[model samples]
Target: MAERKHDRKFVRTFFTTPTAVEGEEDSAKMLRGAVGLRGMKAPDVWVPDNEDATAPSMRDEGAENIVEVVAENGADFPGEIHPRVVWHRDSPATRYQGFKHMLQISDPERGAIEHIDGFVIPEVGDIDDWKKADEFITIVENEHGLEEGSIAMSVIIESGQAELAMGQLREEMGKPTNNLERLFLLVDGEVDYTKDMRAITPTGALPPWPELRHNTSRGASAAGLIAVDGPYDDIRDVEGYHERMTDNQAKGMLGIWSLTPGQVVEANQSPLPPENGSWLLDVGGRKVELESEDGVEIYDGNRLSLEETGDGYVLRVGGDGRELDEDELREELLDMTEYVPSMDDIVDSMEEFEAAKEAGRGAIAITQSATLRIDGVEIDVNKDRMWDEATYQAAMTPITLFQDVYRNRPDQHEELAEMYSEDVVERAMDVGA
Candidate 1:
């Protein structure tokens, strides 16, 4: 017995010719010879729907080995194709379900389709038109659990109405959900020269030309994932495409894709970095370092110092050592300063000099005799009377004078008033001539 060939051969090709029968036969013959099926069992051929008619004998001769048949263009077959062929249909329900089946069967890695997936064409004009689209999105989220930033969806912008409604669509889809991530914009329709003409070259002599303007209007939050699909004939003529993309990136756009591989390459090359640390504030010139009693030193780059004031720590800046009147600090200070007594009230209790004399306090005498006058004097007085009345009056006289001066003519004695109490003034007045 001859040994069978062990080598396995595979052929891959696409059928684009108009004659489907010839294409299928050619594909089958190519595979049969490559797989060594001349004398033994013949190899099977797999042809897409367009080329299926060529293999008339395949149904009887090679049906058993034929693994799968894919229908390329789904437009012709409504329900004839396999239930598994994930159709890109216009019906939202079917498309959403088909997307889920594709995910399950494809068993793609998590986040694999996040950067590339499907598109969503939002309803234009009245918001009521969007009710169906929103409901469809909710179904995708609740039933499929797709998650934002995990899949891409594009919106078709074909009409003037769609352009006007772009803002509303962005706002509605800007939130986090397990439906999809990103939005790709598709601009369709022709430029109307009569309505959209603009003067060119700025020469004022040249005739005006129609200007084509299409935009990917994105939400402030969704700017990062915003993109525009294109194969536009006049895209190269657009003055601000690159600038718009740059601005979009500044507003947090990840990148832009115009559908084709070339566009994808260009967009991916200029993608914003995944994580930007640009917002970290620099405090080199404005910072201050403080050492606490616990030996814990803190370098406050913002110049905010926390120090114990009364009940809590007060915030102060280092330069002028000025305490900040933060709301909390003010509240704490208000609590602390309540019911505090002044220095004058504390010192007014002193009554008599004889009492000080009894307590062995020495009196200071003037070096030279000074002209002094006594008022309301009754010189003849008993020791007890002198001690009780005269000594008390002498001790308190200075205090009384000081209070009178402070109340009557305080402008001249502002400094003295600040430093010394009323009792000190009264004593000085009594001793003076």
Candidate 2:
């Protein structure tokens, strides 16, 4: 993977606010409001959108709004600002228009270039098409006297050739010059991709293209860029949005596009680790949690069964049963239970392991115990999780995310303090320091 160029720690939410509203008397009212501190609360990357979100008639005014609003509030905004410029591989006219907008917004006189992180080019086609957009930005940088490769280029993967070019990104890293290293993110546009593929769906709706999301995640990882899922059009379906985020999180795509402020807050917090820890049982291929009655853990799931034999208790897993003594049964049951650590639990474990490593221990074992009752038979189950250097590094991911959020979104500090407490937040901020 190529090294990233910018200083953004992580991008959990990429939010795009429309630059102009058709009926609104002040066309740039939406853009002006979105650039304020309250409007830019949770998103790590905030975009003053000048593309599809705005109509063609208002785009010229929209560009001026981006420059004006960003100049006024960009200094106080916590997130990185990247305007979405209009571009199409098929039309040189549209591409030139986008280039002109980039020049207008990026001119040093505007005072918005310092706050702007990059530009998101949409409707990108093949590798050569991608290079043309990059070249335009290079010229804009030279024309504006900005440093070479200062303005990053992020492309949306909305076409088959663009998706295929992702695999070729590493090879084309520094062919002509190191400008490609200015690449920041690989965003997905599933609506256009679906249209491009001519896919027919039963409901006449956009298909949930899981393979496209997977490919985007893999491609971004291979090229050392952030992968962001496209926006969910149904803004009111909070539960559905969470489900999609959970699925995307499993694929290592932590970033998601947010169209509304409510969705921005949801997407920002969805990728972080759970606030509390819980235990889950792996039954066949599904994860089921044990039920608790009074003070005893009860296992009454259909996938698992317990039988009492004359010799001993027999544990049935799916369709297989094995006779085991009380101690063996407890061991078997504990092995089936997986402990998902909460953010606080992870911090505690990492701190303990860090101290151990400082004291010359190569590896350490931590014991976690739970009590459960099976068919009137009660047993104490204990399991040990071994932690090494690699385990500690892996455990730091959530902590690192917390630190990034706490640093970038001071507006969310009180919420973070309430969720994880001030002490844990302080420790998180000091983890890598």
Highest lDDT against the true fold, candidate: 2
Please give, for residues 1-433, the per-residue lDDT of candidate 2 as tens digits: 4567876656788899888778889888877767764523547888888999999998888899899888888888878889999999899999999999999999889898998999999999988899999999999999989998899999999989899989899998777664788889899999999988999999999999999999999988888888999989999999999999999988989899998888988888887777766677777878776776776677776777888778779888779988998778877887778877777788788888888988999899988777777667677887789999898887777788777777777878887777778887777777655
lDDT by residue (tens digit), candidate 1, 19-102: 123335454343222222111111011112211222434322222111111211222211111111112223455445434533
Cα displacement (angstroms), candidate 2, residue 24, comes to 0.7
Q: Using Cα atoms with residue i matched to residue i, what is each candidate's TM-score against the true structure?
A: 0.27, 0.88
